[model samples]
Target: MQTVKPALPRPVVAVICDRISYFQHNVHAVPETYLRALHEAAGVMPVLIPACPELLDLSTLLATVDGVLLPGSPSNVAAERYKAEPLPKETLMDLHRDETVFSLLPSVTAQGIPLMAICRGFQEVNVFYGGTLHRAVHERADAIDHREGDHARAIEEWYEDSHLVSVTPGGLLATLSGTQAVRVNSLHHQGVDRLGKGLRIEAFALDGLIEAFTAPDAPGLVLGLQWHPEMSLGHSPLAQQLFTTFGDSCRRRQQSRLCTKSTGGNDEFISAYAV
Candidate 1:
């Protein structure tokens, strides 16, 4: 008999789309950096999950992908989702994304799919798990000013590492980054106010705001960051480490899927549907 080799399944990651308006036309968009990271750094196929309510079917989609990437966006998570009234000047909300991401989380947690949630995605994870957020971190009594000096400055200056985040020693975040402290850019005015269910702090900023978090109780890998690793990868070794760790998790999930499919074995963590 001729020798044969087994084929490995390609890992597929779902990257959520964003709702946008351009020239009076509605658009569903995904950032090029995020797509590039998933393809170039992570070496996985990224499927853009549409933000439209009418289109998203959470269970089916979650069952098909090895991981999920919740990328940052210009629109902010609406305050109303966490039972808070919106501020007068709150960034225009993307209710489409808000609802879609919330619906997707329960499935991701239950299915053991690795998740890399960044920036606004971090806040969404907080809210999805029953936590609340402060409207503006800079305005809070204890929170320091976490924004660049002027909005008119060049984009490079805006994304520069403006502050340091102290990682929890021996925690998941520290294990992933291999560092106790890391300097990260400050771009957000809002931050976590109350922690959500099953979520734990992984790192905190100098201003005492939560900068990164993970869900310990969840079956799969979950890493949430307040800063943008997608923007910092070139100069930040920690950024490269974070993405590499996440990519490994996704590959593991893909292998698990292949195993179950071949053997018809029961794996609650990798199961597509609940019994």
Candidate 2:
């Protein structure tokens, strides 16, 4: 009898990159913060997906990965995505990234790929799902100042926990964090102004700003957080929980894919594995 070795492979996560001009040369980049957190905290391999508009088959690209992560960036989603007026010329923008991520959102949800978006990526998710954003969250009388502004403090201070967000009851966030409220870092100027379609409020700041949301209709986890959890992955229990949960989801997805391949697409055999 021939021996069949176990088919086990580490889960690989597709992390979207931002297009930027580094040293006067155009480049694709994602912050090291996200890479470190995904590898150390999430326990998964992180692969960068370039923000190239030439890639026409996003679904095909997504098929190779177990999960997708949209990391925070200095750029903001173009106002036109939400039918809002454009920001001043001074605002940082990455049109290539905007187009690539926006295109991938639908397939990620529909294909049952676990997704986690942070900060600017959170805003992108909202805009993609017919939600609008308050371009200046602090200027709103009813909202708190969520901006980590021009203080002469250290970079770490910019990502420090600034406020508490009330978690929605019975939501995935509450279950994951095991608490109704969690303190989070605030560094963005924009926030979700109108709730997106198919998304449930996961958490919000005291001032009623939408801090986090999840697509309940998604086959797998589709979560977005308006904070830099990656910045405190070592110290914050909530951050650790979030990444661990995401990592586990990716591993399960990887297992299921391997099972399908090993079973020659036999549903019964795949189900028996219960991956």
Candidate 3:
């Protein structure tokens, strides 16, 4: 008879929320899609973190979660973050979310916590590392019209694959997908104008816009994708893989924590199997 090993406890992941004004009151919220993906695809329990920098105790918060996820948001990062001129006043900027994410990122990267950033979160990671954005990606001569259509169209169509991105030949994304080219849904007006410090390009659209990146030197798994994989996790194999991989990293982190506590910080024992 074959023996089956016991399953490890599900890891807890912290997901940052956006600050929105709803019904004349400020609300901290994240879309249901990301929460579903975190549960169904990633196999993790998600705890939503409000975008309130004033009340949050970063160290205490990080100590409680195995990993952190920054989901896509409709709002854009303020241009001032990267030492650039502010865009037209019409652009929707979430200063609270920006402050929260920017404050959280340094500690996340420093502590080697697993991070998966998507869409606006992707741009947040870039800007956090001193990179700049195009502000208007479609206006660039070499870039495509990567923005999604207005609310007139059905919501499902907004997340359909918009173009193919060429994954870096030997990067993490290529290894995960087992292919150099992958179709992705694009839904943002701004894009990376300059590569971020300590970040390696993982994939790029055919029009030369950046689509994904990773910080290899970081002690933990750090991935940023400028697409809504959460929207297609039910049908896209790659999307499922992405979330699964992130969850696996979170599990490893959790196991390491438990092993350290049980063994009284025995480095060798924790390192032996955590990796």
- Name the regions of candidate 3 deviating beyond 4 angstroms: 1-7, 262-275
Tens digit per residue, CA lDDT, model 2, 1-275: 98555455558999999999989988999989999999999899999988986864775676679999999987889998999999889999999998988888888888888899999989998888899999889999877889997679999889888999999999989998888899999999988999889899999999999999999888988889999999988689989989999999999887767575653556655555453
Indicate whether candidate 2 or candidate 3 has the larger lDDT: 3
Clashing pairs in 1: none
Q: Over 4 Å off in model 1, which ranges?
A: 1-9, 263-275
Clashing pairs in 3: none
Q: Name the TM-score of candidate 1.
A: 0.89
Worst 10 residues of 2 by lDDT: 266-275
Give all TM-scores, in the order shown.
0.89, 0.91, 0.92
Ranking by TM-score: 3, 2, 1
lDDT of 2: 0.88
Top TM-score prediction, candidate number: 3
Strongest candidate by lDDT: 3
Q: What's model 1's lDDT at 24?
A: 98
